[model samples]
Target: MRRSRLSTRGLTEGAIQAALVAVLALLTRYVPLAVLATTFLMPLPLMVLTIRHGVRPAVLAAVVSGVVAGMLSGDLLTGVGILVAVAPFGIMVGWGTRRGWSGPAIVGMAVLVSGASLVVNGLLLLAFLGINPVQQYGEMVLTMRQQMDTAASLYGRLGLGQEAAESYRRTMLAVLDLMPRLVLFGFVATAVTTGWLNYEIARPILRRVGHPLPALPPASTWRVPGFALWLLPLAWLISALGWQPVTTLSDRLRSSLPPAPLPVPSDLGLNLLALLSVALLVQGVIVGWVFLGRYRLHRALRVLLLLWLTFNPIFSNLLLIVGLVDSIFPLRERLGRRAAPAEVKP
Candidate 1:
C-alpha cells in the first residue's frame, strides 16, 4: 500500500507538471509579449518535478508535455522543439540539485547537456523538417552584410566621417568572418547563459519550498585554475601552427562533400583570442571587484563601477591586463585585506 501510494503521488505530480509545461508552451505560441520571460521559465515545472518525484516520472512528464504541446499547436515538431529545448536542461539541473552539487558544478553539467541536446536534436529536427542549416546561415549572413553596408553608408552621410565609416565597415566584416567559426562556441555560451538563468530563477523558489540550492562563492575568492594560465600561450601556438579545428570543422559541416576540407584561415588565431578575451574579461571583472572592496565601497557602487570600466573600451583592455596579471601572480592573496607583502614591512 505504501509503495502504491508513493507511485500514485509521483504520477499525480508529474501529470500536474506536464500540464503546466503545456500551458507555458501554449502561452509562448499564442502570446508574443511573454516569450522573453516565459521561454526560460518553461523548464521550471519539469525541473521541480524531477527534484520532488525523481527522474522516471520527470521523463514521463516530459513526454506528456511534448505530445500535449504538439497536439494543441497542430504541429508535432513544435512539441519536439519544446522537449528538445527544455527537458535536458531542466532534468540535469534537478538531478544536480538533488545530489547536492555546488552552483558551478550544476551549471556546468546543465550547460553540457543543454548544448548537446541543442546540437543533436537540432540536427534531427532539421532533418525531419528538410531544412538546410548551411543555406539558412548563408542567407542570414547576406542579409546582415547588406544591413551593415547600409549602416556604414548612413554613417558617412551623417558626417560620422569617412574614416569612421570605413573603420566600422572593417570591424563588422571581421565579426562576420568570425561568425561561422564561432557557432559551436556560441551554442556553448547560450547553454551557459540559460543554465545560469534557470539556476537563479529556481534558487528562491526552491528555498521557499524547503529546499535550498547552493549559492556561488564570493567573487573575490574566485580563482581561475592554474592550468588556465597556459591558455593564452596555447592560443598563440594555435595561431602560429595553424591548427584550425574550429575553422576546419565549420568548413566540413558546410561542405556538400564528405571528404572536402578547407584551408585554414590566416586569422584562426583570432577565434581563440576572441574566446580567451571574453573569459579573461570575466576574470578581470572579478579582480576589479576584489580591488574595489579594499576601498570599502558599497557593493552596488562597486558593481556599477565595474560595469562602467567594462563598457569603456580603454578601461576594458586595462581590465583584461589586470586579469592576466592576477592569474599569473597571487594578486588576491597579496592585495586582500590581510597579509601584506614581506618586503612592505607593515
Candidate 2:
C-alpha cells in the first residue's frame, strides 16, 4: 500500500489540530462532560490529523497532545501516561490510512489508545500513591464479595432459586480470580464509550479550539458498524444458553460424583489457565467479527466487549442471552448481505 504523503501544508494543519486536541484533553478534567474524555478525548486530534494528512501528522500531533495533557495532569509520570495512551492512535491511524482500511485503522487506534491509557494510568496511580499491591488485591476480593452478595440478594428478591444465588457467588469469585482478564475486557468498554464520545463531543470542541483537520469525516462516521453492534448481543446470547447448562452440569457433577479431592481455589496454576482461556475466547470473538462481518471497527469493538461481559463472568447467563437477543437487527443485516441473491427469471 502506498503511504499518504504529507506535504508541508499538511504538516502545518496537523500541528494546529494536535494543539486543539491537547487543549480539549486538558479541559475534560475540569468540566466533566457526559463523555469520559480521557480515553476518547485525547485521541480525536490524532485521528483528525491522520484523516487529513495520513499518519505522520497524526503522530506529531499525538506527541504534542501527550506533552500538553501530561502537563495538565500535573506529574511527569502522568505526562508519560498521556503519551503512552495517545501514541498508539497515531501509529494505528497511520497504518490504516496507508492500507486504505479506514474503519479498522481508526478502531485499531482507539483500542490501542484505550488499552495503553488504562495500563499507564493504573501504573501511574500505583507509583504515585505507593499503593500496596497485596493489600489492593485483598481489598479487591472483598469488593467482589460485596458485589456478588448484592447480585445474590437481587436474585432472591426476584424469586430466583438457590442455583441463582450460587451462580452469582461463583461468577463473582470467577471475576476476581480473573483480574488480568478483566483488565483486558475493560479496554473494550473504554474503546466503545470513548470512540462514540470522541466523535460526538470532542471533535467539535477541538475544532472550536482553532484546530481543525482536512476534510474530516463526521466523528459519528466512526459509529460501530450495524452488524458488529448486533453481533455483540448474539455472542452473549450464545454464550448464555450454551454455557449455562454446561455450568450447571459441571456443578452438579462436582457435587454429586464420588468426590475426588476438590482442587484448591488458591491454585495459581489453575487460575492462570482459566484466565488465559477467557482472554483468548474474548479475543477470538473479536477476531471473528473482524473477518466474518462486513462491519466497521467500532462495531467489532462493541461486540467484543459484549462477549467479554457476557462470558467473562460479569453478568448472568440470562443477561448474556438478553444482550444477544438485543443484537439481532445487525446480525440479520449482516447475514442478509452475505446470502446469495435469488436467481433471475428466465
Candidate 3:
C-alpha cells in the first residue's frame, strides 16, 4: 500500500507540474499586453513553481516560461533574465526547508528572493535599455511614488489619516529595502498554496492509478477575517521591533520626495476613523476564528485563494466564474477522501 501510494504521489506531482508549465507556455503568447499593463503577472507562475519544487524545478520551469515568453515577444534576453531572477526563490525555499527554519525565517528568505529579483531585473533593464544607472534609479523612484500615490489615494478615499497614509506609503517603499526577501515571501506563500492545490487534485488521480494518496497536513480553521486578525499582531510585532531602522530609511526617502504639492489630506478625524475601522475589522476577523472551528473555515478560504490565484492579473474573468461555481459546488471536497494521517516515526 505504501509503495503504491508513493508511486501515485510522484505521478500526481509530475502531472500537475507539467500542466502548469504547459499552461504558462500557452499564456506567453499574451506577454506583450500582459507585461506593459501589469508586470506582476509575468513572474507569478514561475514563482509558484519555485515555491512547490524548490530551486532546481523552479529554474527548469522558469526556463520554460522564458522560452515561451521569448518566442512570443521576441525579447529573449528579457525573458531569460526574468527566469534567472525568479529561480532563486526556489533555492531560498529549498534552503529554508533543509534548515528547518521557522515562519519568520522563511519570510526572510522570501525577502531575499524579491530583493534579488528586483535588483537583477533593474540592472538588466538599465544595461539593455540604453539608460544611465542614475536615470534608471530615478525612474524607479518615480514609479514607486506613483504606486504610493495610488495607495494613498485609495486610503484617503476610505477616510484614512495622513499619518496612516504616510505610514502605509513608507511601508510600500520600505519593502524595497528587503526586496529579495519580500519576493521570496510572495513566492513561498504561492508555493504553499500550490502544494495544497496539488495534494487536493493529485490525491484522487493517484487513487485511481492504484496508488495511495500522499498524506496531507491537518487543515487550519480558515476564517478570512480571523486569519487577517491573527496576522495583524504578528505584523505589528515585526514592525515595532524593526521600526528604528525603517524610520531611519524613511527619513532619507522622504527627503527625496519631489518638492511638489502633496495630494494627501490632513484630516485627523478621517484618519482616526479609518484606523479605528481597520482595527475593528481585524478584531472581527479574530472573533470569527474563535466562533468558527478552523477546518470548515479553512476549506472556504482555500477555495477563495485558489480562485484568486488562478485568475491572477484578474483578466481571466472566467476563472472568477469558475471560483463561484466551485465554491457553490465544492466538487473537490465531495470527491476526495481525507488523506491518511501521517505516522509519527519517533
After aligning candidate 2 to the native by TM-score, how far in Å is the CA of 226 from where it should be? 25
Clash counts for all predictions: 0, 5, 22
lDDT of each structure? 0.79, 0.55, 0.48
Model 1, residue 112: C-alpha shift (Å):
0.7
Model 1 Cα lDDT, one tens digit per residue, 14-128: 9999999888988888899998877887888877888887888988999999999999999887688777888888888888887888988987887788777768776975789
Give a tens-digit lDDT track for model 2, residues 32-140.
Answer: 7723645555665565566556676677777776687677777565456546655565455445544666454455455556666666666866888887544576687
Candidate 1, clashing residue pairs? none
Candidate 1 residues lying further than 4 Å off, grouped into runs, are 157-159, 243-270, 298-301, 336-346
Worst 10 residues of 2 by lDDT: 259-268
TM-score of each: 0.84, 0.48, 0.34
The top-ranked prediction according to lDDT is: 1
TM-score of candidate 1 on Cα atoms, chains taken together: 0.84
Better of 2 and 3 by TM-score: 2
lDDT-superior candidate, 1 or 2: 1
